[model samples]
Target: MKIYSSIALSGVAALMATTAFAQGGTITINSFGGAYEEAHRQCVIDPFEAETGATVQIVTAYSADAFAQLRAQAQAPQFDVIHFSGGQEIVGAQEGLLDPIDPASLSNAADLYDFAKSNLEAGEGPAYSIAAIGMIYNTENAPEAPSSWTDILDEAYADHIVLTDISNGYGMLGFLMLNQVQGGSLDDIQPGLDAVSSLLENGAIIVSTSPEIQQEFAQNDAWVAPYASDYAFTLRNAGLPTAFVQGEEGTPASFITANLVAGRDNDELALKFIDMEISPEAQACFADALRYTPTNSKVELSEEVAADVVYGPDAVAGLLRFDPTVIEANRADWVDAWNRTIAQ
Candidate 1:
């Protein structure tokens, strides 16, 4: 869900469509678990159940799991709606595991930004929320947030910076972003490897999990890390004095989408669920709870919440997206190189 070009969140806000009362039916949707599921329940499920009179069952699953399940159950699909945070929706749509949502059928479609609608042309679902990944710094130690991605390599932060391992999504994204800032690309990740090699040698703590990052910050005098915007809020909520900043160069976004599953008897209920997620109420609820930026143009964010996300058109314009095709093509070799050069 790359914003190929900037689309200003211009003009007056669109009126929110009324959530219609729906008939009784059961639909299943997969959710990214833990806080993502919690937020989903608050923002989408609770309201959707109330409005639609449908029993919505949520299975805890991530991108790969959702796609795998979809593929295995292509004939007798278990899911009616799917949530993807890692571009699985694109592949699922291509593989015919997911259905292309018709904007004409969903009333809230009119309020979405152009970028959100971009995937619809390719028969993929529109992004309902975006999670920005940027510099997550310990404010007490680094009172002034680092200005750029390269600042992670500055000697001033030696032994105090946390670098996620390439196996983890955030690590891969952070590395890709740094690779770009260092004049590298998917075809050439040498720059990032070289830079990160030095950081690892000079005492950068490398971890494979998000909780390890929290431990580093809490127990090891860690100062900064490259992580998602929501985790930064999670860190702050845990009583860590952390603040996030999109590097001057740019920041990467995790495009999370609500997709309709194909070959389902509960299509109406599924589309209703999708519409609820894209609505202002659901979008704003997710934002307030998880700091995920809204894709629906009509959702008005509070100033405080807006500060935590990629809020305005300028920020969205600068949102960097890694081509999943390129990434999937080269990831195995990249992982091998990471093991040989940087992971140790």
Candidate 2:
């Protein structure tokens, strides 16, 4: 059974107000590749193509690399819309590579969470969906759910913990949460650095990628790790005994945003694409398939998916988000500190 919010964007209001029928054209955007690329097709791309008659080209570039590509091609923009799974939209806006999104221009904008439109007032892209970064633990090894981020630090779970490197998005959020719980803000991350040192000293194992964490949990007997919520569902589906947590200190959110390229010739088409992305139907597709919590207030999810992700306004309200600009600014120093801590 499908349920949705009352304040609706009709087919006309949702897509385009100026045109009666969609005239066919080509638009381009970056892809995270592999399964995500396929999910993109299912959630937004194919439906968009069928309706608008637009050919959407895919550039296989993840967030940081995609931003680099945007900077390189700023003078002659190739991708009409850039999908920033990482929060590069903030940095991209500052560089003028991204056009500020006016929430008024999109019909569905009114139905988004306040945080979803927080950046819109500044002409930045709105987050279409969010995923939380929290604790992922093996039920077999740790039957009790952890109450706080510090639980991973306990010597009892020392060697069993999997520490993902901070360069990765999931790792970055996980580390940021650790740092925040340790009284480290984006400016003063030393406390977090100290915590990592103690964690390493206590015998935490370091892994660099998401898949690596899965391997540790499955074959290496990893008890717990700080990772994304959706991935915990992935682990559970992989036949591992696992569960996710939003630690008491707070949870960090990873936003998947769609942005407009500043000089792109297809503002109309691009806006339509962004509109479709935030549409209840498309957002529900992401929720069902990826466990991505919808940023659009109108989208509804089944009970199972809702339970796995941070859903609804109240839950989303408790989520923590560090400024993307700050993270982008201090990233180099943070990674260096992380490396230095692990080296000793």
Candidate 3:
């Protein structure tokens, strides 16, 4: 059965009433596991539940595994929302697995940055999702901070760096950065594969799970990790010596696209949730607590926080946004080449 049908959205009054009654309906959300998940609970899910009186059932998995599960259940999706990277979103949209977003229903559409709007347009032909900001490191590790991607690979920080396993999204992004640095096109990222292989050869430890990385940093087992800007903020707040550095080549950006499941029973409620997810208040809370760059242009962030986010004018200017279409089309070849190169 379609999961959307399960959502009851008779009207705003009903929504309020359902909330007041503590009706105990659940909205399943899929996300990356561990600290990132915990951060979401603190920043988004908990507040959303308190306000709407809806129980949020979170499902955690690696992005690739999550996408595979979503595709497997295309006829009857399980989760109300799936948080995925831009490449996965592009592939899903191209395959007709995602529903287009209606801007009119989303009151916070007016607040979205032009880049976020444009990114949504290019990915799903409408504002199907908000731009999810990512960054490389946390400030506690490097107080002065290296200003570019080159710094991550520098001799000074070599042994001190910790990176995600090859299966993770950030690892893939690291590959993309290597490809760019080695003058390889995003369409053919073999150079990136070589770079990562070199790192692995050079004794770069791969921590596949977010919790492990968080713990490592917390215990001072490692000083730096490649992670999302929001996640980096989370580590910082947890008293880890971490900081995000804008790559000299440019800061890299990614997104978490929203999709309406096909044949879901409660399409309206699903849409309403999507609308609420993009609302100014929700976005502001996400930014303030999670340290992610809010896509909504209307939300005003303080100078201190704004300086750390990836969407600010200077940050955006320094960002090198990858083209998802190219990545999606070439992923298989890229993965195959990566496997062969890294295996050696």
- The per-prediction CA RMSD against the true structure, in angstroms, equals 6.2, 3.5, 6.4
Each prediction's TM-score versus the true structure = 0.91, 0.91, 0.72
Candidate 2 Cα deviation (angstroms), residue 130:
1.3
The sequence of per-residue lDDT tens digits that candidate 1 reaches over residues 215-310 is 988888899899888888888888998888899898887788888888998887788788878887788888899999888878778888887887
lDDT of 2 by residue, 1-344 (tens): 13222223343342465343355588999988987788888888877766665689999999889988899988998999998877888878878888887788888999999888787755578788888888898887874778699897787887888989999878988888898888888878888888888888877888998899999999988888999888988999999998887888888988889899999789888898899899888888888877788988877788888878888888887788878778878889888888888888
Please provide, for model 3 over 86-170, each residue's C-alpha lDDT reduced to its tens digit, 9 standing for 90 to 100. Answer: 5576677667766666666556666666555553433352232233323445455544466655555666666656767546656
Clashes of each: 0, 1, 20
A best-first ranking of the candidates according to their lDDT comes to 2, 1, 3
Residue 205, model 2: Cα distance from true site in angstroms: 0.9
Question: Which residue runs does candidate 2 get wrong by more than 4 Å?
Answer: 1-21
Better of 1 and 3 by lDDT: 1
Q: What's the lDDT for all of these models?
A: 0.81, 0.83, 0.61
Q: Judging by lDDT against the true structure, name the best candidate.
A: 2
- Model 2 CA RMSD to the hidden true structure, in angstroms: 3.5
